[model samples]
Target: MADFSPPDDNKRTGQRGAEKSGRVADFRYRPPSQSKPQKCGTGSSAKKRGGGKTSIPSPKPQGSAPSHHHRKQAYAALDLGTNNCRLLIARPSGENFTVIDAFSRVVKLGEGLAMSGKLSDDAMDRTLGALKVCAEKLRRRNVHLARSVATEACRRAANGPAFIEHVREETGIVLDIISAEEEARLAVLGCHILLEGGEGPAVIFDIGGGSTELILVEPGGKVPRILDWQSVPWGVVSLTDTVGRCTGSRDERLARYADMRRVVSESFAPFAERIAPRAECEEEIRLLGTSGTVTTLASLHLELPHYDRREVDGLIVRSQAMRDISERLSGMSLEERSQLPCIGNDRADLVVAGCAILDSILDIWPSERLGVADRGIREGILRSLMAADAEGERHRREIRGA
Candidate 1:
């Protein structure tokens, strides 16, 4: 089995100004535009910047349209990650953008990639099905300019390229397999705005399905300057699948959880060394997390009856509280974890590994509080495309003036 079910579409509802939906929201700030963006140096790579388009008609949320111009200029971003497939459609509104329609589904694309070193057939089918839904949503929304991406799972899979072609042929959507560096960058682009006001260096991380990215950034820059990044080969899906089953008493389960943490902690040692000097003057430093593990944990921390993106995003929970939750969760059996509100049966087995990973991260960088963000690669991709669009518009205006 693929480990996840079909997602219930989060329909936009009645709200006057800037309302947020489930697992998606209107961010408080947009990433500052880059004065100069380093190019990938190849023509093929250059063309990937906002290169695809496929738009169709779709439903809209209740409320007055922000602007006719906003509707006329629509952009879309699709992110097929190791565990979840997500889509975001938005239009420029003032300095930022408003999400018009969005979709997210857990496909568990890397369910067994850790040991197998390849995407399983069931996982591929699940992912492709979710992508098809994204295609339809994009079409219905008439998304003109769009960028679709696949992350760690596709990068390491044996038949990743073939699967990309298959997705295109079947869903009329193209998926770009991005590098680890780009993946970390996009994640930062999408989520860095969630960082609380601080001048000290920051650590932003995304705990994914097959890998976890730990990025060190120097704050106070337009887009936080990515000083260094490390992609550890341990995500929730890969970690859980590799950790074996937890079928014993609470002590045994906690021991297994501890083992997972040890493995992740060892992986962080090298990264920790590189940043050891920076840890000296840690005043005003911040730690922000973007991933299912963090968000799910945030929901658990809040004890929300169901997941709420608006409430969770930008939320600050104390480090001790997060640890408490992880500790409490580790003591529970898989069945107990599955009964959790946001976790359910589909995510029950996977959440423990996630908690373990989170524990390891806290061990490395002990911040007072962790910022939660429901946004990531998709949000990052949208910012890139919209920024490119704004630049193109300026260029055209200059040409006309001349």
Candidate 2:
């Protein structure tokens, strides 16, 4: 394995905390870049604007393999983040890994962390139960190489270290608390392949439950060089906590959402100065987003009956249309947003916070098209492990030849 650790430090899966606005970086700005979503999608199938790519789909449910294959070894990646615990079990194929099984559950581990620096007992219990499921899956799969990680919530909570100890005792799974820089690197590793074909710089973002990561990359070959990356401490859960749930009338609700956006935009100010000029570079500036926020918006844009990763993954939506949906959702009361088919009570409040964050990104990047990805750290971890497995094989072959 390529030591999943970066030169410094770093660390999602399908299914994916709590910090205030001023912690990550303290800066603010209102740039004039005309940030807007140029296209949006609506239909029975996934949305496809002109120039975008969907991710490689998970193997079919009936997918199977011979047990005697020498080169194929199953690997597992478990991601325990602020809002979700997710597991991915996969085997290396030619260029990609085929998933054998996957598990995801919303644990809301950082639900109130923005207000309280400690992880609440209830949240810890919820996350522990989810981890138990993940641990069982990894053990049964007999994973060859596994890397489990805990993100922002674990990085911020006062009881985070204690919780990590408890998780190992209860589930026998060890989690590494990664740094913000590493978080941005893995996210780019996982999704930069989907960036629109262009010589200009592209922005890839992962809107996590407790924080948001934005990476600016200048496309080289297949991998993107991390030109500059920023991690803002405001995700769906944390943002909602910072800017209270929309509890008043329609106008009041919109006002609250606006307040949330302001907070997020302030955090992006420092980065905005560096990234804003790239919009006019004339190379091919595009934006790729991987997070629950993008996935949900892609679903609403597609008007699907329910959330479908197959359809939503890699879908490109109009920046304007996404903002429109966010605007409408922000105007609705929590009860009304919850009633929507895709977003129920549990996600009702958080979705609006996600919208605020997305809007801020759109304002900063202003890409006509937005790419939505259903994969992140989990896929990145699997990719890295598979690469090492292949490298080891080649090295052994060379030794025999020598």
Candidate 2 lDDT tens digits, 144-197: 777777889989887888787677656667787877766776677667666667
Q: What residue runs in model 1 are displaced by over 4 Å at the alpha carbon?
A: 1-71
Compared with the true structure, model 1 gives a TM-score of 0.82
Candidate 1, 205-272: lDDT as tens digits: 99988778888887764577777777777788877777765559988887788778877787777888
The TM-score that candidate 2 achieves is 0.83
Clashing pairs in 2: 10-182, 12-377, 12-378, 16-84, 17-209, 17-210, 37-319, 37-320, 39-318, 40-318
- The estimated TM-scores of all candidates read 0.82, 0.83
Clashing pairs in 1: 56-139, 56-142, 57-140, 58-140
Top candidate (TM-score): 2
